[model samples]
Target chain A: MNEVADLMVVLMAMTNLILLGTARLTLGVRLVGAQGALAGAYMFAANAEHPTVHVLALSALIIVAKGLVFPKVLLRTLEKAEARHEMEPYVPYSASILLGMVMLASSVWVSSRLPIAGLTIPPSAVPISIWTMFTGLFLVVARRAALTQVFGYLVLENGIYVFGAAIAGEMPFLVEMGALLDVFVAVFVMGVAVFHISREFEHMDTDRLSVLRD
Target chain B: MTMYEYSCLPVVFGLTLAPFFLGIINRTKAKVAGRQGQPLLQAYFDLWKLLHKGAVYSRTTTGIFILGPVVGLAAIVAVLGLTPFAGCPPLFSFIGDLILFAGLLGVMRFATMIAALDTGSSFEGMGASREAWFSSLAEPVLWLSFAVLARLTGQFSLGAIQSEIGSALWAASAPELALTALSLFAVFLAENARIPVDDPNTHLELTMIHEVMVLDHSGPDFAFIQYAAALKHWVLASLLAGVIAPVHTGHAWIDITAALLTMAGIAVATGLVESVMARLRLTRVPQLLVGAGALGVMAFIVDIMR
Candidate 1:
């Protein structure tokens, strides 16, 4: 179970890099969804010794919220916004990949320096969580599109959830359910925001959204 | 088998096998486009026919134009001697020969560039400048990759570095190995003037880099340029192959066979890239090459971490 969880950590890091390098917003969203599902699997793998019904239920909620609900909302937002591609990204794809690697390495270094004795999860879990969080933040800052920023938010949420799973044996079911609801509502609102942005601007470029300020 | 026996094989086999890559690439492109291509021996036949014909020179050009193909071909052959195939050590090895091998490519490019400049044609001059600029960016990537490999193998010679990268090094640092290989692959594509950099088939002078530079050469001179280009392609491809698929079956014969097969695979892969990808805008070429340099740096970083 530890080996599988360790492998899952590496797999999540790979998906993060893939998200960083891809120029298509749709592909990025899809890769984030895959990362979310892998995180859900990681939750179970990390908590194999202390499995409970609450743990199972929370993992399921995470998978539904992150893996299915978030991606569907973002993909629809992409469709409605008519912005399938991320054109003229703030950072180019290749450089983003290099930056992503640097971030991953730094995250691992930062996690290593942290006091992680309280978490019974594998040593790799801490690094993976921190790296995912860093990548999510990078996505939000480095991308120019609003929909991709929403994905960045979702990925950020997934990272926190992984860290929570690694530290806590079982999260309370009500808190898990409420967190999922909050995410769903946030994405719903963001999706609507994207539509409105598209309707007003005819394109989903947030860089041009400065026209709204005056 | 002994090291002496292995050393001479790559030189003989490389010269014989280099031109066939052009044929394979053409056939693969043809197959993808659903056309019946020329025979696999077409590149060889073209070279044969060209060598039999008389040389033609531009009236304005000096002797530098004649020396370009000769120097370029000699440099490539020297590079071939320095490079390892499969797990076999090269015929020549010296400390810091890796840098010398890279310098040989620079020499070849210099010769080509001077030859192009000597033609005194605007198009050739433009091509020469572009080549010089792109190659300047590409050299960093090549060196960075070498740096990573040198760190991993603790060897500075190209032969030593390549021959030492066996399954153990791969097992220990697969990600670093992969990053370096990818970096080198990008350098290979750009250096060889393949698609996404320069389209080999494009007749448009403005769209060419390497081809435009050689536009004045004809007959035997052109033949030398063609064969040298093919050999250059083979050397770069073999460097990549040596990294990505360092299959050492212990038996020298099997290792040599694996190397040959991998070269064929690289040729096909190049064809597929040409068929699927559109060439980038001329301005985007530097970004692509710089990205390759970034990959190499990342590989070096990864190796350091390991």
Candidate 2:
């Protein structure tokens, strides 16, 4: 169980780096979907020893919503927006990957310093969750496209879910469902906003939106 | 006495079989393109032909031009002595030898770059510059991957680290080893001027990185450069093969055979990569190299946390 969890964590980290490096928005959306699926699998793997109905249901929900449904929503938004790539990001893809590494190292350092009490979580769980969150936040700040930022939001939500899973072991069923519902609604709203923004501005370059204030 | 004699096998294997792996790569590429490939001994035959041909030098050439192939080959041979094969110790091993390994590679590049510069040709100089830039990005990843291995095994020397890896270490940290193997593979590709970094077979000088620099050398000098390249490829591939297939059988013969087979597999893998993907644009090359470095850093951090 621990080995499986560790492998999934490493895979999640790879996806995070790939997300940082990739320029194609569609590919990025698919990668985020795959990452969400991996996160759900990770949740299942981490809790494999004592599989409860609530945990199984939540994992399925996560996989279905984030992995399948969210990407479909994002892809639709992407199609409507017609933004093929995240050109001229605030940070270059290579630099973003390097920054991702820095964030990973810092997360590891921070996780190492934090004292976990009496939890038998997989050792890499905390650090990877933190790294995922950092990658999400960085994506949001660094990328230019509103759709990609929404991808960032979904990634951020995945990180939060993983962190919760890692720390709390068996989160309450109601809370997990509620969190999932919240993210679903949030993504729907973001998708609509991106649609309207791209419709109004004729481009998805969020940086150019500053012109409206003048 | 027998153990002492057995330690020299890696060097012997590398010297004799280095070009064979190149042949394997060419053949794999050929086969992939739906054509009957050159014989597996084509590289050896090319080396033989180049060796017998007469040398030619321009009146403008300097002594450094002649010294390039000699020093590059010599540096690679020295590095090969320090590299282990399939958990078998090398001809030489010492504390902090990984630094020496990396430094020797740098020396090889420096020798080649200066030699290229000595040609007084703008094309070679451009090649040399690109080589230096890409390698600078690649070197840190190499060091970081080595750091992960050292941390995992608590051994600094290449031989010690190779010998320490077994089923036990893989069971403990497969992810780290996988990441290290990946980055090392990238370094191997970049250093060898393989596809996706630089196309070794490209005729257009403008696009060439490593091949363009060697344009002036011909006959025996070119042969030496070619053989040196084969050996360098073997050395880097051996490092990757060590990580991917650290087959630590108790018997020396089994280990050597496994290592040889692994090298062939890697050659085939490289060929498939070349066949499948075009060489990246010059601007995109650094991104790939940097991504490899990022993998190395991620591996190191993950191993540290573990």
Candidate 3:
């Protein structure tokens, strides 16, 4: 269980960094979906035996919602809008990757201090998950295109799922489902937002995303 | 009364006092600028006036226009339930209550922005965009700042942090807290249509974002939306005060006094700032918010080191 959790944590972290460093919006969305499925697997593998119905349901939902539904919608939005690549990133790929590494290390060190290990899951899950969450936020800030930011949001949601997994028993079935659906819907709505944005501006660069001023 | 009873007061106080705060701030600005302001309770009167009247609808508006203020108020009330104003009596407490507290605020902004879009006017659209942009930056600052409080005292309840932050043990660390407090003050100004970020009196549609968006709203619905905006502003201001005030575990009177004083101080500060500073150009606003994020990050690092 420990080794598998470690691998899941590492894999998710790498995917997060890759999401940051990538310029291709399509691949970024796909990778976010992959990260989601990986997280679901981690939850299932970490607590397969005691598998409460809610746990299984949540894990399955994550795989479908985060892994599948979100990415598909984002890509479709990009496809329709004719904006598929991240152009003029605020931070270059190399720097974002390096910063991501630092964030991962810091997250691990930070998570180690918390008693998540004393809970049902491995301690690494919390920090790695938090690291991924903030990295997603970083991606949102660094990337210029609205299409690419969908990936950033997915990665953040993925991190939250990982954190929730650490304290799975503490949350109720409906609450977990609600949170999951909220993320899914928020992303879905954001996809619609990208469409409207493109309609108005003819481009979806983060710089241009700034039609709102003080 | 017990702590829970004391905590209840702040929540009730929160609901009751938001409009009055707006009244007070407007009066201050008027007095300072050498004009006789409306009565301090004029906001309450405006609410009464608007509510008694009917709404005038725009041809382009949709359901979102109606939903914006309703959801905004709901979100603020939801958030107040999570915060521990006087005695840490949050209606809902959890391990990561702080996150929920901030998240609810984000949700409010999210709803209102979309609601702004529902108006279908380019002016409203522009306001929504700026609100979204500034708020995206503001939310992270909010999260990181509260996370520092969580780490510093090793507590997560919004109320507990308020109380713990009140304790004398942390009082010596003024520099970081002051910076956090100041930056949060900036966020409160930006979030509210306060001066130096937004001029409530502005009639210029081309340059105005917040005012221009609501140009078409009137009567009762406009009143609710405006009141919600005031409540939202008060929530941010009070929370920032909690960051600076020794709100935790003090005499209920002491904590409440400090908190209210902080609120008044925030209003006065807003007026002073409006008097002294000019609103940054539209593009320049993000840099100011980024500076806020920088402060939050700095404070988080400071908390982690401590």
Candidate 4:
């Protein structure tokens, strides 16, 4: 079980790098899907013996919502908005990947001193979650398109959910439900926002959205 | 005179005292701008009157319009519980809370922005867009800054950072503190809708950032909106002050006094900035945050080298 957890941890780290390196907005969504899937597998591996119905339900929801639904929603959004590729980035992919690797290594190095052995599912899970979050942030900062940022948002939220899992508490169902509802509404809202962006500017570049001034 | 044991006290106090802080900020801004501003308790009166009045809903507004302020207040309360004020630790503290604190603020931003768009007004949508854009930049700066603090202090918890930092618990130096303090201060002001980054006193919606988003909210909802905004500033300012204040209160009265003075000093500082400067163009706000991000980078470098 611990070895399975370690494997999940490595996959988690690779997903973080892919999320950092990918410039395709559609691919960005898919990486977020992979992240969510990895997080679910991690949670399952953390405790295989006492997996309850609620755990199964939550993981299933993570699979459907994050892996399948979120990507589909984002793809349809990018499709409707007609943003085909991330044309140019503020930070190039190679640099982002390198920077991301540095961030992950630093997180691991920093977290190594912590007593994560007692606190979390796996000690590496701490840094992995942080790296996952940083990759999301890196993507959001580097990408140009509005849809890519939404993908980044999904990735950021996925990292957070994984962090929550590494801890022991069974999160209140209502809070989890509230979080899911918030994500659904946020995706819907982002859909409307993307349409508005394309409609207003006839292009979905977020840079053009900077018209409002002081 | 005693602080409540529940995590809710800081929240209730934070929420209750929010209007007064706004009043103070307005008064200072008014004096600095050379107008006799509204009374120190003017926001309180506004809240009272607004609470008694009937609400007039816009025809095009959706359920989110009604939902915005309620969730807004809820979000502020949520964030307050995540913080510690004066000598009191948070009612609850846990790992990764620093990130969770940012997440809660994002929730507030998310709720308020959605509500702004729900009104179906282009002006409100404009505010929503600007809010989302700037805050997206500001959030990472916030997380990274906190992460720096965490890395230095070796504590993953929010309330634990200061006690660890203050006791000379960590060997980190003042220059690193300088970078952390300044960048976060910038993000704080930007987050609070203050001057240079944003002018809270700006009258027109086009020229406004945070205020314009809540233009449609009226009555009690508007009161909640105002209080929530004030509470947010208070919370952020408190966090900023926490890094600098000696934090050894010696007594509750001293702690309260120090806390109040710190809050007022921040208000004055904000006022001075407004008095001395002009709002940056919208395009420039990101650079300001990025400038702050650069400061974080500098801090990370400085701390790592140390």
Candidate 5:
């Protein structure tokens, strides 16, 4: 069981590296969806010994909200914005990938230093989740596309959920449901904001969105 | 599988099989383009024809012009002697012989570049400059790959390193091995002047890297250069094969055969790549080479972590 979870965590890290190197906004969104799906699978696999009805229900909700709904909204945002590729990135794609490896190494080092007690999953799980969250923030900060930033936010949420699932076997059902609803509403609002920005500016490069600063 | 320490096998195998790789690649490319390709023995025939022809020299050139092909051919053949095939050891091995192998390749490149400059032809000079620049970036990637293997196997010589990476190492550190193989593949493609980095068939001298430097040579000199080019490709492919597909059948002869087949498969793969993808922009070539360096670095990191 631990072996299966370890494989999933490694795969999620690989997907994060791919996301950092990818140039197409659409492909990045799809990879994020796949990562979300893997996170849901991790939840199911980690609680294999005793999967309660609430745990199963929460996993389903995660898969639907993260793997399906968020990506669809982002893809529609991409279509409406007419932005297929990310241009004028803050850093080169290759450099971002190297940076991601660096981030992964640092996360591993940091995870080793901070010992966790009563951990349900592998000790590496927390680091993997932290690394995924760091990668998401990197995408949000480095990419110029607004849709990519939204995808990054979703990845950040997925990492938080992974941490929650690994440490606390099951959160309260109402709290989990509330968290899911909040994510959906946040993505919904972000999608609308992206639609309006594209309509007003005729392009989706958020790097140039600082004209009103003066 | 038992390791056999031997000599003379790589020399005999290299001389016989090097030209066949070129033939296989050309035929594969031709068949892919819907043309009736030349026979698999076409490269052998071309080498024969060139060997018998009279040589020509320009009045502006010096003795180094004649010395280039000879030195290049000897260096390549020497590198071949230093490489191990299958599970058998190389004809020669030393504690730091891998470094010597790299140095010999550098000498070959230096010989060719100086010879190109000796012609006083601006076009050859341009090719030489490009070759020097790209190789400066590529050489480190090659060494970094060697460093990873050396660190993993705890051996500095090529023969020992190749012999050390048995099934146990593969099972233990598969990711690092895969990364090293990828880095070596990139180095092989760049070093051989293959498509994506260079187009051997492109007649436009302005775009040529390896071929342009030899434009002034003809007859026997040209033949030496051509043979040396094939041998260099063979040697590099052998090195790559040793990493990516190390065959250990417990018999030296069978292992040698498996290694040879693996190299032929690589030739076919290269032809397929050429058929599907266009050459990268010259400016983008460094990025690809640097990506290879990145793979080497990642492999080193993975090895350390393991």
Candidate 6:
């Protein structure tokens, strides 16, 4: 069970690196979806010894929402926004990937220093979750497309979900479901905003939005 | 005494069968393109024909132009002797042979690039510069991969590392091993001038990386370069195959056969990739190499945490 969970986390880390390196917005969306699905699988594997209705339901819900529904929403947003790739990012894709490596190392360092109290999670769970969060935030800051930023936000939420699942023993069912609902709502709102922004401005690059200030 | 004699099998196999794998690659590509490919012995025939031809040299050319192919071939042969095949020990192994392995590759590249520059041709110079830049990015990834393997197996030498990597270590850290294998595959393609990094078949000098560097060579010198390249491909493929499919049957023949098959599989995969995907833009090549390095770094960190 622990090995399965560890493998899932490592795979999620790989998806995060691929996300950092990819320029195609649609591919990035799909990779995030896959990352979300893996997080759900991680939840299931982490609690395989004693299955609970709530745990199984939450994992299935996560898989459906983040993995299936979120990518659909993001891809639709991408189509409407008329963005194919995230060109001219604040950091180049290569440098962003290297930064991602740095972020992962730091996450490992930080997790090793700060151990979770009373939690018997897989050893790789904490650092990978933290790294996922860092990669998400990095994507948000580094990419120019508003749609890509939404993918970043989705990834950030997935990281939180993973961290929650890592400590599922202590996390409340209501809290977890509420967090998912909030993310779903947030994504819907962001998609609408991105669509409107692209329609009004004729491009989805948030970097150029400051031209409206004058 | 028999064990020492048996260890020489990889060297012998590399000397004779390296070009055959290139033949496999071409045939795979041909099959995918719906054509009756050249015979499986096409590479051998080319080598033989070139070896029998007379040499040609330009009036402005110096001795270094002739020296490049010879030195590059020598370095690759030495590297092949250091490479372990299918968990079998190499003919030569030492405490820091991994460094020697990577350095010989660098030496081969340096020799080729200088020879290209010696011709005073602008086209080969461009190719050399591109090769130098991309390889500088790639070399660190190779070192990082070696670092991961060394850390995992607690060995400094390639032979010891290859021998230590069995089902047990893979069971312990499969993710790191897989990631390292992926990075090595990228290095192999990049180093060998394969598709996605480079297209070996590209005739345009403006687009060629490795081929353009050898445009000045003719006859036996070109044959040496081609043979050296085939051997280099085999050497790198052996490294990757050692990591990906380390079949330990406790029988030398079975292990050797399995390793050879794995190499053939890699060649076919390469051909398929070349057929399916166009070469990346020149500007994007560094990004691809850097992305490979990032994978290597991730593997190293993950192994450390494990």
lDDT of 4 by residue, B147-246 (tens): 7888888899877785566636323355567668888899888898898777877888887878888898888898888778888988898788777664
Per-candidate DockQ vs. reference: 0.27, 0.89, 0.02, 0.02, 0.27, 0.82
lDDT of every predicted structure (CA atoms): 0.84, 0.91, 0.74, 0.76, 0.84, 0.90
Q: Summarize candidate 6's per-residue lDDT along B1-306 as a digit string, tens digits.
A: 234557888898899999999999999999999999999999899999999999999877799999999999999999999999977789999999999999999999999999999998999999999999989988998998999999999999998898889899899999999999999999999999999999999999999899999999999999999999999999999999999998887877888889989999999999999999999999999989998898898888887776
Model 6 - which docking category? high
| Real contacts retained, model 2 | 0.96
TM, every model: 0.87, 0.97, 0.58, 0.58, 0.85, 0.98
Model 3: runs farther than 4 Å from truth? Answer: A1-214, B247-250
| Model 5, span A74-187: residue lDDT tens | 888888888778886898876887787788778777766766655657555777788889988998999888888887888888888887877777889899889889989999
Model 5: clashing residue pairs?
A: none
Tens digits of per-residue lDDT for model 3, B1-306: 377756567678888998888877777788888999889998888899999998887787788788877787788888877766655567777787877778788887877778778878788888888777777766776776776667676787776776667546355444457557757877787777676667887888777767776676788768877877887877787787777655554477776776788788778777777767787777656656665655555455434433
* Prediction 2 global C-alpha lDDT: 0.91
Candidate 1, chain B, TM-score (2 decimals): 0.98
Pairs clashing in candidate 2?
A: none
Candidate 5 vs. truth: CA RMSD? 3.7
Report the lDDT tens digits of candidate 6 across residue range A39-153. 9999989998898998799889989998999889988988888888776889988888888988998999998888575677887888899999999999899989888888789
> lDDT score of model 6?
0.90
lDDT by residue (tens digit), candidate 3, A86-195: 77788876567657656766876787677656565654567778888889888888888877777777788778878877766447777877887788788878899989
Per-residue lDDT of model 2, residues B1-306, tens digit only: 234467788898899999999999999999999989889998899999999999888777899999999999999999999989866688998999999999999999999999999999999999999999999988988998899999999999999999899889999999999999999999999999999999999999899999999999999999999999999999999999999998877877888889889999999999999999999999999999999988888888887786
State residue B169's C-alpha deviation in candidate 2, in Å.
0.3
| Clashing residue pairs found in predicted model 3 | A144-A206, A212-B130, B162-B248, B163-B248, B166-B246, B166-B247
lDDT of 1 by residue, B1-306 (tens): 466667877788789999998889989999998999999999999999999999977799999999999999999899989888877788788899999889999999999999999999999999999999999989988999999999999988888888789899887777678878888999999999999899999999998999999999989999999999999899899999999999877898888889989999999999999999999889878777767776676566545433
Q: Which run of 10 residues does model 4 chain B get worst, by summed lDDT?
A: B1-10
| TM-score, first chain, each model | 0.93, 0.96, 0.91, 0.90, 0.94, 0.95
Can you list the residue pairs that collide in candidate 1? none
DockQ leader? 2
